[model samples]
Target: MGTNTTLKRSLGLWAIVALGLGYMTPTVVFDTFGIVSKQTGGLVPLAYVVGLIVMLFTAISYGKMVKVFPSAGSAYTYTRETMGPRVGFLVGWASLLDYLLLPLVNAVIIRLYMEALLPDASPWIWVIAYVAFVTIVNAVSMRSTSGVNFILVAFTMVLMVVFMILGSIQLYKGMGTGTLFTIQPMFQANMEIAAVLTGATIVCFSFIGFDAITMYTEEAKDINLMPKAIALTVLIGGGIFFAGAYFAQTLFPDVSVFHVVDDTLPEIALYVGGVVFQLIFLSGAFAATVASGLASHASVSRLMYVMGRNGVLPKKLFGYVHPKFRTPLFNVIFVGLVSLLAMGPSLELVSALINFGALIAFSFVNLSVIGYFVFKKKQYQTPKQVFSYVIMPGIGALLTGVLWAHLHADAFIGGVIWVATGIVYMLVMSKIFKRDVTKLGMDAADDLTG
Candidate 1:
């Protein structure tokens, strides 16, 4: 690949935000409702509220960092620029669990949906087909991927609206809550705070895509527009999750309603609107998975490309961009191949593991804000600067830290192993600090703008 080859600058603010929303997968609220409902003791909406609040603060920090360093590496780039190369590489390495596995999560979801519709068919067929289609769309170009995502996101939003209407009618007709204005979904007298926090930790997985938007900085038509795009993506996606959860929790206040707590989308649809609506809702869910798969597949490839271009990985293959398509062709294909692992893992396991990496990345990005602005730039002389640089991101760091503490034991163990492996690789690459690990053949100009 030529050193001059860079990501194309074709995405505008709306396009970037659409891709971010696609990555977030709005339909996920229904998919995870039963599990969260059980975890929160029937307060899924409240847990989403907590999750959204946590994400909003972190989103602010992300917006701040992108303005300072507009690169395709997202948290990795911000951390590297603010902290140091080694720390950045470690964060990026740990983040691979979230960035890389998200596509697999989508593939797994697609398989589950297909399996429900056709129990006798081989599920691997759906996984392979979904991965291949998303890979091909992403490999084509950023415009093509974003365009497809916009349509898919639009379709999902429409279905969500229809669900809200149907759910409201059912509630008014004396179902679960028997009223749309009831606060039962948000709170109950016996609900425990600990349970809500635990549920929040799991739902944090739904907010992972907003940060991934930073991975498209180099591809944005105007880098300055990224801050708004990032904030809007979080707000819009969080709003959808909150609304969807509210309706689902109201329609079926008890977790016992779901036969499969780990996957309740089909049941929720069937209960709310019968067989016809269930079929329609499944189509929307499929569209959501495809949209998320395409967006995540695109973002992770760009991230790997950045790491490779920095000489932290096999630069020849991982860093190479196809001149004709202006996309990370090899990285796209590699991620698609990795996504095939979807056939092996359970949805709950993948969801928990994703939260582990996401929380780590979120914690570091918040820290990156302080490291860059308050400590390094010394911009905290005034009250406003102090709040923006110190207080705000500090809160973000604290909240994410709290969530990190609540991660599933299995996820924590797996994340530690991933980070340890990265440390060992960094040690070998740096030759025990004898040489630099990040500056090898890295072209700073290419990272700034396409």
Candidate 2:
């Protein structure tokens, strides 16, 4: 059993990468990029390449940050140092929303996939029961949970490997037939910059969580091994994502006919399986989704624990550590309650809300890197490499911002409305105490300077 105070730094370079890829490749990547083919029609791989490159720049920033000032807070401290406390607080707050919604999305999706296999189990029962089971599993210890993760990740990878091999072979077998699986259309389809850029933006989201591995630096044994871990992670994570996308195209050669806009990974799997292996296709997905739900619970809850330790939020609610299991008990139960409450809306709405918040946080991370490196060049000595970090990442940030706008207006409006309410509450409390934000800012500045 791992204790909170004694965080085991046992995860090595490869394990870290596996975690990132495992969390990503499960139906999420397939569900996300399968739509890219429909939207771009055969040009999906190009968009994926663009996505992988864009992520590389961000990965560079994350890699550097991990070497320099690795922390449990991924964007939290980065925003604080590069931007300001206000922006830092916003990043942390937004992360709370983003990570919180992630688990819920998994919870909801797991139910759907599970039911596709069972066909009669109530979704509510599946979600609640799974949540309870995973919550108990998480409440134990990190070692046990990680043990489970390794097994589940390996199984899912095997499932994906088979899917890729079979799908790719099938695509090649039917090549030059004007089928979606043909390589001809991938380049022949709309090569316009605007469409490619938009597709690239969406594709990038599929690869977003690879860097979250760096957040576990505190639990990594060899500090020098961090770079190797990240490099391998990027390679493995990117490789799987691209492979999955290509396999998806292989599965549905008439890419235009595939129904990706509705997020149909298992359906595509079923399509490829025919009636013989239809249940088998969904079976792998069902297991992956179940593991993903547990992984989501374990990760999102840690953010609360970190925030409490840092004094940015109340230490009381966030500081509790289970004596025996040594897990974040309060955080696990808290996330469960919050997710249960969030089951208020249709699963699709909840999914959009989470995706919105995550992208917004990622967008700011890119912008912060660009602003800090470009405007404040003193922070980074890589002047010769300015074109990559500043020019490219700056463009990526702008593109992410555009997608932030492109998401559902309901999420946009709701996020804005929620932030406004929080700001108002902050203002009223400060005013009542005769304290101004300017004074608070000065105190924070003094603390940093001191």
Candidate 3:
């Protein structure tokens, strides 16, 4: 039996990209288009443009940290190494909400898609099936997970491309809205700028999967290839999202006229192709949700494995890789079990918590870049280095911080409660008053290898 405890470096650049894209789920643009259109008043494309700009800087900051501390812990490692172990632990604690709950969100989304396809089917059935599917795929091996991601991403992208093309052809034939291209979709005459920026915040969720790429650093074949992979993932995901929103907007230029904002794409599909195309769209969407669930489950398991191996959690359980499969089998099962939350909670509530956790993690990444390069290495000695390392990260930190501050009130409360719970656990389990848990956590890293 193969007994390598460490994760194997089995993934190439494109494999990492596929994993990232799968987690992002390009079809989600259609899923959220109605909300985006209503919020932006037909300026969905512009909102995505703003989201892309902000995420690019954040992606750059992530690339910087990946080069310096390449590990599976991601934000936890970056924050702990640069700031301190205590702060790192808290960041990990907060990020746990994001990674843990995201699989549930994707699984629930799968159920939602299934319900739309077969109104008579029980949502719980789809939830159970997807959760089980995700667990089985991730428990096998990273290669198996990545292989599934590649195929799902490929199929989803082809369907999205077809949807866009058919939408364009319908618009050309003067089916609805009478024109194929119009500047109004990007900029409405009387809409407030704040509305567009708020809409951008909503759209920002679509760009989140890029940073998950860093968790694969331990398994990537070429470490340097990670930065390029991160950039490409964000670019490709953003491009797909923008195209979906733009075309949907063109087909139905007036958001106020949309009977139900949430069903915008389904409505558009009905208009453009008929019942057959709507089924195809729903099938593509369901496939994307399954792909997303698999990716998120795999990521959360790896995050737990890294933390567990570092002694941040139970090393014996979380740290143990399957001797034969070389996968974090226990961690995978743990994440899958957590995804059972899909059966209990509303999707909106879980999504709010995810936004809070992910936004904070993004802010921490920017801060890590500043802590490492500007304060530690003193890269400020040169003008070019100062701008690239210091100025850029500073802007990134500020932007992400703004986004965090503006998070929905419900999300803020949910995130704060989760963090408070972590603090309590830290103090109790780590015996903060009796022992130096922070130092112990840092030292625990010496026992393992990447």
Which clashing pairs does model 1 show? none
lDDT of 3 by residue, 1-450 (tens): 222477889999999999999999887776667777777777888888878888999999999888888888888889988888889889988888899988888877776666666879777887888888889988888999999889988999999888878988898898556576787778767977777876677767667789788888889998899899999999989888888887877887766655556545566677778899988887777778788888888888888887877778877888789987788999899988888778666555676678788878888998999898888888888899988888898898888777676666788898899999988888886684477768646555653223
Q: How are the candidates ranked when ordered by TM-score, highest leading?
A: 1, 3, 2
Off by over 4 Å in 3: 1-4, 254-265, 344-346, 447-450
Candidates by lDDT, descending order: 1, 3, 2
Q: Is candidate 2 or candidate 3 better by lDDT?
A: 3
**Per-candidate RMSD, Å:** 1.6, 4.1, 2.2
The global C-alpha lDDT for each of the candidates, from Candidate 1 onward, is 0.89, 0.63, 0.81
Q: How many clashes does each candidate structure show, in the order listed?
A: 0, 3, 0
Model 1: worst 10 consecutive residues (lDDT sum): 441-450
> Cα deviation of 177 in candidate 1 (Å)?
1.3
- The C-alpha local distance difference test score for the whole of candidate 1 amounts to 0.89
